[model samples]
Target: MNTQTLKKPDINILKGQTITGKWHKKKYYVVKELGSGAIGTVYLCVYQNVQVALKMSKQSHSITSEVNVLKAFKKVQGHSLGPSLIDVDDYISANGHVYSFYVMEYISGDDLPNFINRNGQEWLFTLLIGFAKDLQTLHDEGYVFGDLKTDNLIVSRKPARLRWVDVGGTTLQGRAIKEYTEFYDRAYWQMGSRKADPGYDLFALAMVILRIYYPNGFSRGDNPRKTLQQKVQLAIRSQSLKQLVGKMLNGDIDKADQVKDYLLQYVMKQNQQTQLRQKRLSQKNQQETSFHPTLEVVSILSISGLCYIYMTLFL
Candidate 1:
């Protein structure tokens, strides 16, 4: 999430301004600035008595590319990985400067790292599993989440689902990645190219895991691959977890479904081991309970025999 720093927009000027769509004629009252990036600034706005996110950019082509990504996300069949595109139009500012903007579903949730910190690391695997499933769905549609990072992932409650945000980096298979953060980019690690592919996204996912564990983030050392391998070994002690991440980082596991299956198997194995330990402890308690009663009875009988012998001898 700390991958890149963007110049923030002036909230004092952006807030309280009413943006009226030039063609659609829809009005959105800007409540606050949500975030800003190289492409545009996203604002939390009120539209038709409902809160929504509005992204405004001076570049029309960038807006069109992002809109296309959002449209592609809608076709993933029953899964809304990113926000739904609500409205798109041009806006004329007070100075007559035109800007392209799009309104979308406002996802009210925590970013992945903050959500994990608040809820505890126990939710880490479940959240990663959700990411893998969503990635798999996107891959099945012939697209890759080129910039998969903790900053781009949000964890929404009510059902606690993981969703994608800021899909400006999404690209069709075999194309150059539209955008990326160096920390999560394969090219930065010198492991692969910046081409849009399943392996590229998987590598980013591995970096996301490292970011979660090392919230302070890390730098690429003299040996980038060795540095990453050492960091992974330090953070992950579980053999299965380490193996899955290693596969992703090494480009051995390119398919999202493969990563998902590996994680499920690891979880199932852990559950079984937990149940076995509980069963063994229960049996040990039962044996101890039965042995205590037998010991008490034998001690009482020995005391009674000693008393009778003493009385008979005295008589």
Candidate 2:
């Protein structure tokens, strides 16, 4: 007899189900569905009384690929850009269908757009700097974040740094980008190809910058390049920021480290200019103060001399 097709588990039914790893023998209590992606569905679950994120999918190959990516993240030096891979195992559902699943660190934070809106635009540069560094690490390790959008990013509190999530779209350098959103895709804009490279990610980063300015996102008109440039001019008043983003979009700045360096240099130049202006103003104020006191003294002396002359001539 042919086996019955296994349908995607309903959220309501999965909420209270216990997922026991067939090999690891660890159990996780499903709290709720965090998100559903093309590859699989991620759930917020409690493992050994601690909250974590677990992704399960019938496609075992895709699940294994994502698990390898997570492992690669751990091998990268410095910061861990992606979530830490906790456990990898198989779970059998009530229907006796085996599903591949992996548990990862539960990153609790606000999405990029909401975080920036609530905290104000002051956080944009800092977040961008941190994000560039993280991206640099990934690129150095031979990976490109194909789907570079705000939706796949999270801002954690305390130190308030940017963190990447939903890394399923990450692809190795030189290969075709596995997945991408059109708004952020250079190919969609007719600016470049779909081949995975630093430029591809940088172009997406530029779109992400625009996404902040146009929260609802703009449409690609008759000319995508012209449309993007017009929007950049309209939204970004800062010449430096506009130039940086423009370079990224145009593929002029292709590397993540270059982005970081450019931002840091701009920030440094701005600080120097501000300090120079402050110094000049301070000097001008000091000169005015000295002139006022000297003028007062001269006035007093002139009046006393006139009074002495009057006394000498009349009395």
Candidate 3:
């Protein structure tokens, strides 16, 4: 049998199967497939009774660099941008072929766009600021998240936060971006090179915001660049920080702090409005409660007087 046929069997990881680490011998129970991409397949798994995400790739070499990148990210103390790398190992199948896999914290949440739709768009300002800060952290560490897109982001509540899931596109500074979605790629817009820099990520970040703002309208036509530019102009009218977003799309905004500051201001303004509205509602409710008893007492007395009159007249 050829290599393609040999690797084919390992790709279909059945549910409930156990994948054991080659070196440490730790075993993880496969729960279900989470997602699949060009490089590998990810599965939800339980390791030592704790939920984790396991990524398996047929070509082990393809993910070796990503593993190193993740290790570097893990060293950044208090980094909440993405899930912590748990373990790395290779699993030997029954046929004795080695398949490489790595485990990371399982993020339980909806994707960025879905979460916004479900939770309400009022949270977008906070979410975007948090996301920009995360990118800032990564950039500060001398790395670029080449493929920054909504699908790669997860937003959770109970302490609403955002986390990056797929780290395959992460690359060190000065290197060309390894991977990117067409719409999110700066090169696709002919605005800049694909070099892994802060500008590249910032440009993609701006695209992400525009996408969330106009999900259906931003389409890829024959003239994709012109189409995107038009969409950006329209988005500016509908979205806050129009000039900032325009600058970002043009590869002008590189500092994440700039975006964060603008978005933070918007979030604070929205929060104040919400609080004021809530306070007014509370006062209205209080007034209605205070007036309710007097009306009830007057109504009871009127009914009693009517009953007495009826008794005197009819009895």
Candidate 4:
């Protein structure tokens, strides 16, 4: 009776440590920190042993824009580029900051942006096909991934096929969700031009393909800056980069297939040949290095044998 009456109370302790998960009335357990945005930190969360992305707000109206943009995509008849929504929760932070949390589908793969930075040219023609198709789809639906850099894209994490992810629909993808009428990305800048415009995004896409799939001994980025601009612009008439502008407006991109084919055929093949040539040169150097050591040793042995014979004869 005494032991039962004097039981010590157990208190949940979470002091001094920044942990992510369903904590203190939260719904999920935080596994690892993926990244942080203008809002709060994004953590790889777990619930029932499953994974998900929990993005908590950093400031006012941050999650509102993201949620609005995501909701806009859901209204579209057929769109699967963006991550599927799971759940949303809102609360006030310890510092009196009101924040919203979004539970999003967790993509188990390498982020495309990081992959491109590391291995951009390993598989040229294949990635071009999928990427071009997705870009066309986005164009048809009047959405441009504001940030088209490699980091925004996702490739396979294991030794499997590379995949692209993070489809930002509006100019920011996380911008004003209600205003979906605009089909242009404002951050794209023309090479010789000043402001960032919609056409710049298209040019950016083409540039990504060109830089990654250029198939010559010279490579996509090896050429002088102006020369590269000239090469890309050559296919787009008018010294300006307006090739993608007309097609984007027309809402018809059947011609893009031909362009992708031409890029892989002309660009990737030439680049592969160049890489092969360099590899052969390296192998030849190794062979020369290997042969040199053996020859030096044999020459030394021959000289030593002759010296001993000559010394005996002289003695």
Against the unseen true structure, what C-alpha lDDT does each candidate score? 0.87, 0.87, 0.84, 0.51
Compared with the true structure, what per-residue lDDT tens digits does model 4 show for residues 124-230? Answer: 44565556655556555555555454444566545434343343324432233222111122221213221223443454455444434332313234434444445
> What are the per-model numbers of colliding residue pairs?
0, 0, 0, 16
Candidate 4 achieves a global lDDT of: 0.51
Arrange candidates, best lDDT first: 2, 1, 3, 4
**Candidate 3 wrongly placed segments (more than 4 Å):** 1-10, 214-217, 222-226, 232-244, 273-296
Against the true structure, what is every candidate's RMSD?
A: 6.7, 6.8, 3.3, 12.5
Candidate 2 to truth, TM: 0.83
Give the TM-score of each candidate: 0.85, 0.83, 0.86, 0.52
For candidate 3, write residues 1-315 as lDDT tens digits.
Answer: 346634456476899999988998999999999999988999999988899999999878666777888889878887775788899999888877778888988988877777777887667777778888888999999999999988788887667887789999998989999989988898887878999999999998888878777775355678766776777777555356677788888867788888898788877787898999999999999999999999999999999999999999999
lDDT of 1 by residue, 198-253 (tens): 99999999998889889988999999999999999999877888888899999999
Please write out the lDDT profile of model 2 over residues 9-42, one tens digit for every residue.
Answer: 6323378888899999999999998988777889
Q: For model 4, what is the error of residue 57's alpha carbon versus the real structure, in angstroms, after optimal superposition?
A: 2.4
Q: Which runs of model 1 end up more than 4 angstroms from their true locations?
A: 1-13, 281-315
Q: Considering only N, C-alpha and C atoms within 3 Å, which residue pairs clash in candidate 2?
A: none
